[model samples]
Target: MELLLLEGVTRTIELPDAPPLTILSGVDLAVDAGDRISIVGRSGSGKSTLLNLLGLLDSPSSGRLVFDGQDVASLSSGQRDRLRGRDVGFIFQQFNLLEGRTALENVMTPLLYASGRQFWRRREIASAMLDRVGLSHRLTAMPHKLSGGEQQRVAIARSLVREPRVILADEPTGALDVETGGTVMQLLDEVARSSGAALVTITHDLAIAELASRHFRLDHGVLTPVSVHAAEGLIAVSGPAAGPATDAGEAS
Candidate 1:
């Protein structure tokens, strides 16, 4: 089943003195449960813009976004906020952990503001999630006290604490060394697959995108799927044929 859908989506931002810039143009995509999709592009290629839209952090200029068969554009602001909290989790390029909060506390944050759960119950769930992410020993350590990989794991724990249905990751391994990045990517893949959650990762590195189940590239406001094998060792590509889908306008 389709867990997420985008139809004829477009986004345009007006510059201070320049003409309106089209970040995304008539884009269509459908993501199913347990699907690991990657979005790749160079700087200023609308990859981030499209991700923001998928995460509900930004609205498109026109078109529809549907989640779990419901039209997201038809939801109220409060409804959208609730949906974002309950159905979507985000992993940013920057770890974005609270400096003062311990790893456990950071992971418990989503439950703090969450409704329908007792405080003690939330804590138990958060602790279990941290333990699952291999941060059981670092539970009491502050974000600054942990290694880069540990910090990222804590962030992952936080994102997973709420049991979200989908995860939108923006350059999730950008800050780590190659070995560490591979480890992190493996962890992400394991968690998403285990939980049956759809995953969308945005990155400029083809190597990183190779970790996903479906590989796609965004360029000049278009999205195309490239063969996973072809993107394995390539560093930079400019053509649409690099992926499996040549139609820059849609994805199945």
Candidate 2:
């Protein structure tokens, strides 16, 4: 059930007039089916860089990255693309929906690329997904007309439409109000659980991080485990797999 694993992973970007900048270094993480992991970090803490690597949108500069037991470095770009499309679901803070399309159309986009039954029944599949997200009444609503929460829900439907093996949620509530954001996160967690997919959320809020079964903090390109129960009432969930790392309770 190990879906993704990263060991000694490092990502560096070359600068035009300076030495390479290391965005992430010596990071180790494992994601399993039905696991919920939260990574807390601030701006420039390499959270987005890590997200890209997890989603297979980018490769590591060094170290090993294995997705579903295959070495990432050994695969061609096309193979990676196909694998990512088939197994990874992405949710962004901005709810990257197509402005020109309706909610249903946006969800159907993924299945359109799949083979056989999925491709032929893209509309049916997409409609069912929207209904599952409580958007059946607004299937044809345009992005411009939907509220922020509605838009995010549409994005969620789209992500889950493919029934991906893992869900990568990047600051998923950054753009919504507290109440709406809470509702959205609950919906997301419920659907992901029902689908038996691993959920990985990267966020700056400790409150958000506490929802996961295991937590980690990323700072200065280093990843350290955090025990959600060690904060003297700061964390309340008593997360299942969180391990204590020195200074893990410090601000990110």
Candidate 3:
């Protein structure tokens, strides 16, 4: 049931008259169907770079990356685009909803590229997904009128409507209050579980990251699994990011 995997992956960029910059180095990750993984990292820690590779929007400079048993390196740009559009869903911190589109219409956007039944039933499917996220009454509400939490709910419904194999949420609750964020995370976890899709959440918030069954920390372009211990008003992590898998401790 492994949906996406990375082994010794590295991402580097070239600069004119300067040494090559490496964003990620020897990063290893395995994502399976229904898996819940949280990756915590600060800004400029290469979390975004890793997410792009995971979503098939970018390829690694080196190493093996496989999606559903196919080597991503062998696929053409067109093939990669089609696969990402069909199987990968993204939820952003800003919600990224269409400003002029209604909740239902925003949710239906992904299906616009689909064929046959999905394309024809786009409205139906999107509406149902909104209902699933407890936004049935606000289906026609414009993004400008919705609260931050409500807007994020709409984004969640939109991301899940396609039943993607993998969902990438980049700082999904960054803009909401703690209470609203907790509620949204609960809803997201429930829906993703019901749909059997892998959930990969990238955030700097330890409270939010702890919600996942498995946890990892990414620092200076290196990733490692960690065990989280929540104390009174504080969180303590005990694991070091190492190059090899044997050096990391997976909590789950």
**In candidate 2, how many clashes are counted?**
0
By lDDT, who's the top model here?
A: 2
TM-score of each: 0.90, 0.92, 0.92
Deviating ranges (above 4 Å) for candidate 3: 232-252
Report the C-alpha lDDT of model 2 over 53-104, residue by residue, as the tens digit.
9999999999999998999999999999999999999999999999999999
User: What pairs collide in candidate 1?
Assistant: 225-243, 225-244, 226-243, 226-244
- Model 2 residue 252 CA deviation in Å: 6.5
**Model 2 — which ten-residue stretch has the worst lDDT?**
229-238
Error of 2 at 55 (Å): 0.3
lDDT of each: 0.82, 0.89, 0.88
Query: Backbone clashes in each candidate structure, one number apiece?
Result: 4, 0, 0
lDDT of 3: 0.88
Model 1 TM-score is 0.90
1 against 3, candidate with superior lDDT: 3
Give a tens-digit lDDT track for model 3, residues 47-147: 99999999998999999999999999999999999999889999999999999999889999999998889899999999999999999999899999999
